[model samples]
Target: MFRRKTTEEVPAQTEPRPERPGSKGRPTPTRKEAEAAARERAKLAQDPKAMRKKQREMRVESSRQVRQALKSGDEKYLPARDQGPVRRFIRDFVDSRLGFTELLAPMLLLIIILGTGVLGENMRLFSSTLWIVTIILVILDIGWLRFRVRREVRARFPEESLKGVVWYAVMRAVNMRFLRLPKPQRKIGEALPERYR
Candidate 1:
């Protein structure tokens, strides 16, 4: 007897369908559900206290990173003043020399002590002479440093801007070797590397 199969008579397929390669493998969220999720996110974003805390935390983390960069000479996190290849070259140039200005601080302190008459009245004239000599030496050294830095920078970075670079080198030269930010990469009297990019 050729009869049509009844609903109850048909066998159910138990095997799972194979998934397509690009399928998400889950049901898409309904519009209402998606809207609710977006609203929750917006609410969190709009919370003033939470936003302030997050911003403050971010600023602290950024400052900490910059400080670490300054100490370690990590170029990526260095502050704007210390950034760029030209500044780096200037730093290297300055650090390689033993400048007289580095001693200026101690010389000034000695001058101050002598001026205070703590040592003796007789020492005052000697202190004045020492102060005058220190000033002259510092001025000469700085002038030389500026001239040399300008010449080298011009030769090495012909296309780079020289603005503020001479001053930058002078300032770095004035600081004690151990106190310089972005700590010296080259030793005193060490020859600078040919390329600095």
Candidate 2:
């Protein structure tokens, strides 16, 4: 039966509260555990001198690989301009043909020397002749390159952006074949498979 209680009387204590569950995340570590972990981390830390030496070796190896890739025209490691299959094809196509643009560098050198007024009165005629010839040949070569590359690129990659492709091809063509980087993959007059042509 319920007891009648005096002013000082108290109710019996309720059952002790149940323990709260721990969080799903890692629990807080004890002092000994924390100290042991700290010691392990210190032991595993690398020496600064050795770490630097290892990093330098890694960099040197990486650079060597990149150089080899560039020389061999490995698509995976090529610069952005030469990375894509379309660009590779463009390079090959430009390289495999002989075009007037191949004379661009030499012709430019001639123009520069002639324009310096060293030949006196003949300078004007010489400069004008060289300029005219350079312009005509370069234009003709670029036009032909654009037409051929556009056709082949369309055949091979119908969805590729034509934007900048013409310039890319023309620039490659303007340089002598041997001087071009990622040196020509195909021989002169060597054709791509019939589907690409």
Candidate 3:
């Protein structure tokens, strides 16, 4: 009976939704759909009229690079020893020169996480526990796979530099989903052109 305060209604607190359009989007594509969109943009850049103008451009020379790279060795592109450090770094960074199947999905997950935060909201990419858990799983999976691959490399080439951890934290992203028509080639990170860089 001596209590001075009575029960008061309390207002529920809500999370503030981050503003958008007002803010520029992160530079890289965060999802497969985004990457597809980027591919279409690339096609348009290569040909403003798209297919109409695309018919005029010659691709015979472009495929030559792929052939030359393939013919060069068991590994695509020139050997790292022969290439400039910059080129070699780019090659190793992009193509998952470390391991293929194991790294594919993990790299994709990483790119999405980083891409989401490119604009402003530091928490934009991971506003919830779900995203955080997904990222953690990706890291664990990649770490586990890399450890296994490195073990094999060590066993096979014990005397040589058998350790090439291809894990990169950067937003380096690139994809060419040619089969998905009207999609631009999506490339992120250091590979980004100087203007975008």
Considering every candidate listed, which one attains the maximal TM-score? 1
lDDT of 2: 0.81
**Which residue runs does candidate 2 get wrong by more than 4 Å?**
1-45, 117-120, 195-197
Residue range 1-197, candidate 2, lDDT tens digits: 59876778677889965545554445689999999978755654656766577678878988787777767887656777777778888888888888899988888888888888887869867888989989998898889889989998888899888878889898888878778887788888997765432
Model 2 residue 63 CA deviation (Å) reads 2.6
Model 1 C-alpha lDDT per residue in residues 54-117, reported as the tens digit of each score: 7798899999999899888988799899998899999999999998999999999999889888
Going through the candidates in the order shown, the clash numbers are 0, 0, 6
> Residue 78 error for model 1, in Å?
1.0
Candidate 3 clash pair list: 38-184, 39-183, 39-184, 39-185, 40-183, 40-184
What overall lDDT, based on C-alpha atoms, would model 3 receive against the true structure? 0.45
RMSD of 1: 13.3
Q: What would the TM-score be for candidate 3 when compared with the true structure?
A: 0.30
Which RMSD values do the candidates have, in order?
13.3, 20.5, 26.7
Model 3 C-alpha lDDT per residue in residues 11-75, reported as the tens digit of each score: 78788656464465445447998889789778888775785555455355445554565444222
Evaluate residue 12 in candidate 2 and report its C-alpha lDDT on the 0 to 100 scale.
89
